[model samples]
Target chain A: AQRVTQPEKLLSVFKGAPVELKCNYSYSGSPELFWYVQYSRQRLQLLLRHISRESIKGFTADLNKGETSFHLKKPFAQEEDSAMYYCALSGSLGGGSNYKLTFGKGTLLTVNP
Target chain B: GAGVSQTPSNKVTEKGKYVELRCDPISGHTALYWYRQSLGQGPEFLIYFQGTGAADDSGLPNDRFFAVRPEGSVSTLKIQRTERGDSAVYLCASSLGRSYNEQFFGPGTRLTVL
Candidate 1:
């Protein structure tokens, strides 16, 4: 079964400091990874995906096949960046089934000003 | 364009009662999904629909949990004999054609069982 693990339950960083949220997955096939963010009173939304290789809101995640990790990183943390982050993995079943995403226990990030 | 929308933003019900949560996907999205989010945890996949057919219902916890997308645009999740454990925010999402497509989420319906 495909599984995602986010080790940290909570992470605190000062404004302007670098931050990293760890994520590891166990999947046999080539997996697509994603990072989702949910701010207070807001819906959970996509932040970045491994396949896109594009940064969003100054956040980036690199997919490491050898380590089976897709860790989200940001060079500078802003106070507004405080939110809950979830790491997710989608199994490749070739069609609409690919939309089924298995998510990890989210990590709460608090950027202190 | 309007994103995915869910009705009854908040619902409070007593145990053993029945409840229905609704979701309206994006106008052209062909795939829709339902997920349940408990406190302090990531959302758990419940079921998914491709057009009007249920492509995956394996994530559903039990037979008491049922869903339908009769018109292929709006979906309803019905739960019977609700228990306190069922109290959580139910989320809905939809994507264009589903092959690794990005999904847009709804605001979610918070269900509380008393």
Candidate 2:
């Protein structure tokens, strides 16, 4: 079985400060990782994926195989960046199910002015 | 053009009653998913549909919980003899396919059982 762990339940930072949301996963086979965000009163949406290797809203995440981690990072945090973030791992075919995602508990980010 | 949509943004029902939550996936999306989210927790997978068939329902809590996607566009989640423990935000999402693509989500339906 695949599992995701997000140790931090909440993170607070000042505007313009660097921010990082840590995520770790345990999977036997090749896994797909993704970060999703849910702003206040908004639906959950994709923030970034390891496969894309692209930054969204100045946020970027690097997949580390040795660490089994995909930590989302932003050099300078903005007020608009405050939201709930969830780290997810996609179970592959070899894991018994490939369609569903195993998600971490989530971390609430607060960017103070 | 639109994202995934769920009906009855809020639902309140009594225990032992039956309830059905609806989900309208994005047009042309072949994969749809249902998840349950409790307060302060990330969403938990309940079921997944690839086209018109249920590819997975392992996450479902019990036999009282069932879902169907006959037409493949819209799906319904049926809960028999709803219990207070079943109250939570039911989220619906859809993706282009059953692969690792990003899944678009709806605002979710907040179900409250009394």
Candidate 3:
């Protein structure tokens, strides 16, 4: 079984403040972690993936295997960053080779201007 | 260069009725996926199709849910004896292949069970 947990349901930060959205996961094998974002009236889109190790839209997330966590972080928050963010996990399980994302409940980030 | 698209942006139906949602993936994409998002929850995988075959249907909640991607380019999700709990946003995504490719998502169809 695989699961992703996002502790905060809602997070608020003023513009230019640093923001961090916590995510924890439970999976037996090596897992791939990803962050997805959905803006107001917009479709869900990929924010960043751990494997890439590259920041997207001024946000970056590092996968910590020892801690079993992948927290999304941004140095300076902008009002436009307000949206729903989800942490997802994918990995091979039970020998059946298929990649399906298991997502967290989601964290709604409100960047106050 | 068009992205994934889903038909009937919104649908309202009564309990015990049947309904279908459609998805049109990007041209040349070989992998299509279906997901459901309940209120205040993130999207949950429902099914995955590789080409014309279903690579995974394990995420489906029950037998009432069924999906098909006959031509490998478009797909449809069907629900029978729909319940109020089935009301949610049905999301469709597509990727060039099933591996670690970035999946492009559609706007999603909002299903409301009355």
Residue-by-residue lDDT tens digits, candidate 1, B10-99: 999999999999999999999999999998889999999999999989999999999999989999999999999999999999999778
Ranking by lDDT: 1, 2, 3
Ranking by TM-score: 1, 2, 3
Q: Comparing to the true complex, what docking class would candidate 3 get? A: medium
Q: Pick the winner on DockQ between candidates 1 and 3.
A: 1
For model 2, name the residue pairs that clash.
Answer: none
Local distance difference test scores for all models: 0.95, 0.94, 0.93
The chain B TM-scores of all candidates, as shown, are 0.99, 0.98, 0.98
Model 3 residue A97 CA deviation (Å) reads 3.3
TM-score of 1: 0.97
Model 1 chain B lowest lDDT segment of ten? B95-104
Model 1 CAPRI rating: medium
Best by the lDDT measure: 1
Between candidates 1 and 2, the one scoring higher on lDDT is 1
What shift in Å separates residue A61 of candidate 2 from its native position after superposition? 0.6
For each candidate, the DockQ is 0.77, 0.70, 0.71
Q: Which ten residues in a row have the lowest lDDT in candidate 2 chain A?
A: A91-100
Cα deviation of B114, candidate 3, in Å = 1.3
